[model samples]
Target: MDGTPLILTSAERTRAARLLARFTDSYENSLTRRPIAPDEDRETLAKLLAEPFPEEGLGVDAFFADVVDRIVPYTTTIAHPRFLAYVQGPPNGIGPYAEAIAAVLNQNCNLWQISPAANVIERSIMDWLTGLFRLGPHSGGLLTSGGSGATKDAITAAIADRRTDFRERGLQENHAPLVLYTSDEAHRSVVKAAALLGIGLHNVRTIPTDDRFQLRVDLLMHAIAEDRAAGKEPFCVVATAGTVTTGSIDPIGPIADLCAKEDLWLHVDGAYGALFILADSARDALLPLSRADSITLDPHKLLYAPLEAGALLVKDMAKLRAAFAFSSTSSYLTAIDDAHLLDYMDHGPQLSRSFKALKVWAALRTFGVGAFRTVTERCLSLAARLGEHIADAPGLELMNPVTLTAVCLHMPGRNAEAHAELLTRLHEEGTAMLGPARVHEQACVRACVTNHRTTEADIDLLAERLIALAKR
Candidate 1:
């Protein structure tokens, strides 16, 4: 096996080009219009995949054709404008093309020597983001897979920054019972991160939220005091800029003040709403985000990059390096040559990284930052319109305030199961794909207008259909 053939023949190269072209054409065409359900048999897919690996390869063209005919159909139509299910959106126009180019380059972006332009590009991107938050030159961060990974990494850094012995000894070392606090309205990622760090799910305190769905600052303060009185150390507080369920923002100004008074690390999960920092109305409000020690944002969610692009920014670059630069013991390569430029490996947990920055940089360059701002503003306005429509319609009630792009509504008399059915019907009818929400322990449907392609007509159509259903 070690002495096997190492090079591809001309036949294989031609076949590969044909196959790649076929799939690329298919993907490009689908993005031009609404995604309709494909009329194809799914059973044959299993049969095709079940066959053993051929002794003689199918070459490139056949493999590519099969992907076009068999694989693309089963994928979710996430790029469709009507896909308003979760806090997700269609990729920006340049995202796909940039991704393809990045694949061809195959730059291992972990080191500066391997990815000189990429290192500078990523740094420039991070610098621009830090400037948005009003963070000083000392601030720096790294990109992660998604918001979940960012939050986990931030919390890990917070633990290390606060605890003197956290480097060699983990949470189990002191057993001093350090506690972390977050609003009940925060995304579940916070709880999951704590549990992963062995912080004990029981030790993570869940503060209650107010009527507007914002984290209650008074309740948070009270909880911290009680925990301290009970002999527990309160070291960090995780706040939200845009929550998952209702898109409500916690009071960042007051949260920051409290963290400063108590000497606690403050981490803001701004994955869903941070890019709204581009929105003019939100720019002033989010200024307080600069006070946070760390922040999490997802380029995939609001920046309209393709899947799996999240970031974690820290006010102090040294803190980020101290938290993640543990596994630097590599003897296989020349270490000095890579250290001249910022090695992304020292910035995050992963070593073998991909050129994820290319797609993000491409989208920003092709469309410009102002374009994203307009779309974000449009989404917020669309959601506000949705909330108003729900309030005016009979039998429909606004479940939560329309703060960002998520608009949740509850039908007073409808059962939870019935609401789920309505969601299914809407998707089946090609109207839209919405998700269900449990607000105030009552069943409801949620519409997240995160797509740049959505229009006022789309918002009105959704409300009109729902009102008609309720009246029936």
Candidate 2:
């Protein structure tokens, strides 16, 4: 080995920095003009897959060249103004810098001894989120990989809290069949989590929803009563704050009331729409979120932080610690007594964690919370505007009521294949990228304005083009 091959020389570092500057500069400057998604080049892609690793390092220039040329050109431009296919959003301007710094430091965020500042930063972030949801003084949580993991972890706590023997006996040795309640409109992550945690698909009730796509509380109560009569134990109820398809929110207040009466843990999967609470228009609908026993919200979607930054806020910190902690007396992970400090290992599934809090913290501090609220409000307004346009457009119709940013529109006579074809055309023609969805089992297209770059012009153009193209 020639003088430590891993560490770059000063000249190499300079070259790498210049390349990164050029790459970011070019990307930001031409983001709008670029295609939302590049057409697939199978031949070029196959070469990448077939390529072997080289024994020697490709100098800094060649490595940068490959990234900017071979890799980037083929990737979907999610930052594009018209890339409105899903709940995903472009990262805030500050998020990238914070991510870079986080990478540079490479802090292990498991314990205060290893990452003192990171531990407090994560704790402070959870405090703010808990306060935002009005989760009361006893609440605490930790950053997770995403909402799915957060939901799973929340359910873990639910089981531990309800069944004292959970740590010892687990689901296999349970006395009765454990049932978890959720709505038809709830995320697949709920079912997946239950199934993974050995709750079984049969025990997870997917109650039907009303015409508004909201979970029917009456049906929920009926199901719970039936389960109880059948000698099954109902332990937790998973509610949706914002559904993936229509952005529909379940009736959290009534559900909370039911949960309180039945002593069931209420976990609100707010990954898609919970952050809309920041906007004044949606505050009334989302206010009941504070009543939940646990919540899963994604900072990546609402705050525009980079990916892999989802939050799980629980009603009581002790419950979460009890569910996940190995032991408070673990020799290696023990920390000095500090009220502000939290060993994140005791709060969630992970022991080795990234400094995910920094990217979110940086964005909040740089842009201010008001900026996020404004962006959220604007996205809601855009969705309403789009729905109105679709309603006014002849031969096109709104498939669902525009409540949040997801606007689903239908062509009156189109079948499933026809709808799929329309989506393909939308992408192929570079008109815009919209997702295929089903409103009450009828196929439609969904345009979600999660991108801050999406404008009135972008929405109008997509609507007009869609109107003109549907006849064909």
Candidate 3:
């Protein structure tokens, strides 16, 4: 702690509460009318880069003013009703309060002793996830920065399972180069994870997908057999529960079976699509995810917890612990795990973690799981509504089957540049912020209905506008 006191007085604290309420009310009120993607503020950016800390403190009032005047205007409103550009979720009503409380508590959620309540909160969330996926007994996981980090850690666990001496030998021993397999449409993070773990990109096989954009199980088996013939040690298969581009789900059951036969660790990167299992419409398609050795999820996406909350669940908790556990002898650093609680530091790479689970838990408790189930199901319905419009419209093509909440559409003769122009027009007109997409190497546009605030009318508006643009 610093020698100079930074504590607020009772009067200041009361004023701070008033300021927060005013800001939230003002911001929320302006959201519907303001543009989703604000234009660049180069002047503000330059000032921010050049400015240094002041010798005198800028009190809470000035800080709030700066946020309201300078920061909020430039930031992209990710919570906007039409923010379907990426797989992002808006914050739930209770999450911001939970986040505030978590910050006030300042829990270093890495150990049980220091953050007993946090440990239980995180464990409880993971328990619900494990049971939801039906990963069987002795399954557990931890929250990471997001889906990318979770994927990286999942691969680390896979490598450790491949070689018992991985932690000790560090891949220096005499052994064939490890191979990782994934569909071409799998998230780029999987490739990055393999490369970072010293699994050469050459050994990472990009298996082809079927017509539905699902990984072709027959081709995967062929690739594994070819790798085996070449004396390559195939270690893991990364499958997608919901692929990013088209929301296509790979045949999880088939991929899991192949992994089982080949003795490869099966990891489902369910970052985009897995949580949809909460919705009845999506549950049957996602149920096969349970067979995987490990699964990645993002509560920040479907759960609508604040940003930067991703989780990785493994079939066996012991394997996960073995992969990341460190034996410490220092009295200050020593910790133990029990049925009631466990050290989160032993689950993943980071030692200093925030209390992300509180937001997730609080939101679940506040709104109830049934509420999110409705939101997800509604999102799926809205996407389908868009898909129907595209299919029925003239010169507009439904590029992919509306598998989840992503609807990819194309113009009959529009080139990549034309599609780019259309997206720019949408952004400029403040109609909606949609992302550009490609299907079969042909450019198109994709609208992902990940926001709970998005409605059937919003989808129809976008669809009608696209149809109008395609006419040009």
Best by lDDT: 3
Write candidate 3's Cα lDDT for 222-338 as tens digits.
999998999989999999999999999999998888888889999999999999999999999999999999999999999999988999999999998889999877688788657
Off by over 4 Å in 3: 1-3
lDDT (C-alpha, whole model) for all candidates: 0.85, 0.90, 0.91
RMSD of each: 2.6, 1.3, 1.3
TM-score of 3: 0.98
The ten-residue window of minimal lDDT in model 1 covers 331-340
lDDT of 2 by residue, 1-472 (tens): 5586688889988988899889889999999778888858999999999999999878989998899879988999999989999999999999888999999999999888889988888888898888888999999888998999999999999999988889888988748988999988888999999999888999999999999999999999999999999999999999999899999999999999999999999999999999999999999999899999999999999889899899999999999988887765667666665677888887888888999999988888888999999999999999898899998989888988788888998888879889899888889888899999989788899999889988999989998898898766
Q: Candidate 1, overall lDDT?
A: 0.85
Which regions in candidate 2 have their CA more than 4 angstroms from the true location? 1-3, 328-330
Relative to the unseen true structure, what is the C-alpha lDDT of residue 53 in candidate 1, on a scale of 0 to 100?
83
Please give the distance, in angstroms, between residue 441's alpha carbon in candidate 3 and its true position after superposition.
0.9
- The per-prediction tally of clashing pairs is 0, 0, 0
Q: Which scores better on TM-score, 1 or 2?
A: 2
Instruction: Indicate the TM-score of model 1.
Output: 0.93
